[model samples]
Target: MDVVIKDRGNIKWTAIMLPEHVAAVKQEIINLEKVNQPLLDEDRLSEIEMLIYEAMEYNLQLEFKLFKKGYIESIIGSTHFIDYIKKEFRIKDKNELTHKIPFQKIVDVQKV
Candidate 1:
């Protein structure tokens, strides 16, 4: 999907995502939540929360790195993955450009 983030001048920046990447992030969050749920102590809960956030942050960073390295699409499926990309990449107006296109198609268009 394509998400559009606009600057002050209404200049839009688009973020592209694959369904698989989104799903993988969602699964990661679910797994973290599952791991965190068993802890009852406040300190442990806090630590788990922090860990979850860190994991998500790290995942987003890694995804961006992969994107830069030309791994444009993900092998998993989740919309939340795009949300992470939006936040990590400082994207805006995600609803504006959620279209699905082939990765190669986007790359080809970008070349123009």
Candidate 2:
């Protein structure tokens, strides 16, 4: 006589998870998807700075890609305030909500 056995991995364990444990597992999955920040060359950094300067001087709308906490975030807005000493700038979005970002966090810049 022979017996057959089957293996159920993580799915079988999920049945015993409480609601809070399930939520925590979902959040862990999301955190696992986060990516490392991209490195920018000097030429690329110069280009981004030039674009930002033009946007601020000409009152043009610009889109900025930022690296924050291992995630890439996009912001569309016009440059509102720049603090040179602090090396950070503020942008006002379409909804007039201002967001302050640091120079080192900038990944890319484009005209809108």
Candidate 3:
């Protein structure tokens, strides 16, 4: 005759953890999943700026890749507002929702 054992994984430890401890462990896992923002070279930045200007001048829809809170996000829209003083620009998406994005957060831009 032989005996077998089973692994319960997180289910077993969760029962012994307090609510706060469980929450902290969950938060730590989320933090670990996050990534660092990428750095763009000057040439790439200039290209993105050019694309933004071309899209705005020709009234074309464009897609932008942005870095936010250690995550990469993609947005498709047309230029809405450009604030030179604040160094941030706004875009109006298909739903007519406007989003303000900073230049530093910009990763890549493309005409769509």
Candidate 4:
């Protein structure tokens, strides 16, 4: 036997929200109003591509400042691949895990 109570009080709804529902709501908020990722222009994308390609060809370390989730984050790694068509920067982190990161909101680039 199971019993489910509803329509009890306004504040009680928070207790009923499942983890998946909460995550969805948070993602919606980020997509609609919270995040501040600026769109990178074509020129800037090309410049960044050059930097990534140079790093890839020379086995050099590169660092990038990316805008995401209402703030900027920096990642330092060697590029595994730059998917220009998909606009994803596939990089190998220190743990040797390759991550496909969104590169459309790059704020700064530096080679280390």
Candidate 5:
């Protein structure tokens, strides 16, 4: 993972990761949020939101990089990627092994 911090003072950041890595990081963030739910103060909530955004940015970067590398057959939605993996990997059971990522908010990676 390679991240380029855009606005240090403003708390805006960006990161690039492989598609698999993005999936892993997204799962990690979700797990962290679950564990920290009890400590959800204003500041903690803001931190969690930032973590989610950062993970999403990295996912978009992965998509773009894969497109550039010609690894993906076509540009697809993130949800499609999840489905594709499940089908291709023959993952029928959704358990702790499969990190269920929450829906991603729209992120404008082009502007970032």
Candidate 6:
């Protein structure tokens, strides 16, 4: 008999699970993710979008709190141009390099 030790930290044994079991595990993981996700509803998304639009229109510098790969990041810049098709903003930072900030990544915005 082969003795196999499974480590709780890794899921290597999941490879031997029944197809149905593997699907159930995947679904459970997805459901668990929803419980901890940040609440950003349509209204809030629209509000953030509007704020960016206003800043771009006035060529005003602004600050943002946004999520990047599950970490919060701070950015301050003026909206140099908007790429509507790409749904991102090209910002002119203090250093003068253009930065692309995805619309969906923005969590909070304020005028600088």
lDDT of each: 0.33, 0.91, 0.90, 0.79, 0.34, 0.79
- Report lDDT (Cα) of residue 20, candidate 5: 84
TM-scores, in order shown? 0.21, 0.77, 0.83, 0.58, 0.23, 0.59
Worst 10 residues of 2 by lDDT: 4-13
Q: Give the CA lDDT, 0 to 100, for residue 6 in model 2.
A: 84
Residue 101 CA displacement from its true place in model 2, Å: 0.7
- Candidate 2 residue spans exceeding 4 A from truth: 1-13, 16-27
What value does the lDDT take at residue 46 in candidate 5? 68
Candidate 6 local lDDT, 32-110, one digit each (tens): 6542226689988888778878988888888877776555688899888888899988888899988898877777778
Q: Comparing candidate 3 with candidate 5, which one achieves the higher TM-score?
A: 3
Model 6 TM-score relative to the real fold: 0.59
Candidate 4: Cα lDDT at 37: 70
Among all windows of 10 consecutive residues in model 3, the one with the lowest summed lDDT is 47-56
Higher-scoring candidate on TM-score, 2 or 3: 3
- lDDT of each residue in 1-112, candidate 5, tens digit only: 9998666642232255566876786777766644211223566446544543554555422221111121222222222223334332111112313223322221211211
Q: What's the lDDT of the predicted structure labeled candidate 5? A: 0.34
Clashes of each: 6, 0, 0, 0, 0, 0
Candidate 3 lDDT score at position 36: 91
Model 3: how large is the Cα RMSD against the reference?
2.3
Give residue 34's lDDT in candidate 1 (0 to 100).
40
Q: Distance from true position, residue 68, model 3, in Å?
A: 2.2
lDDT of 2 by residue, 7-108 (tens): 797789889999899899989999998988899999998898888888999999999999989899999999999999999989999999999999889888
lDDT of 4 by residue, 1-112 (tens): 8998666663566578987987887778666754567777788778887888899999888887888767778888899887879988888878887877876667777888
Where does candidate 5 have its weakest 10-residue lDDT segment? 61-70
Candidate 4 accuracy as TM-score: 0.58
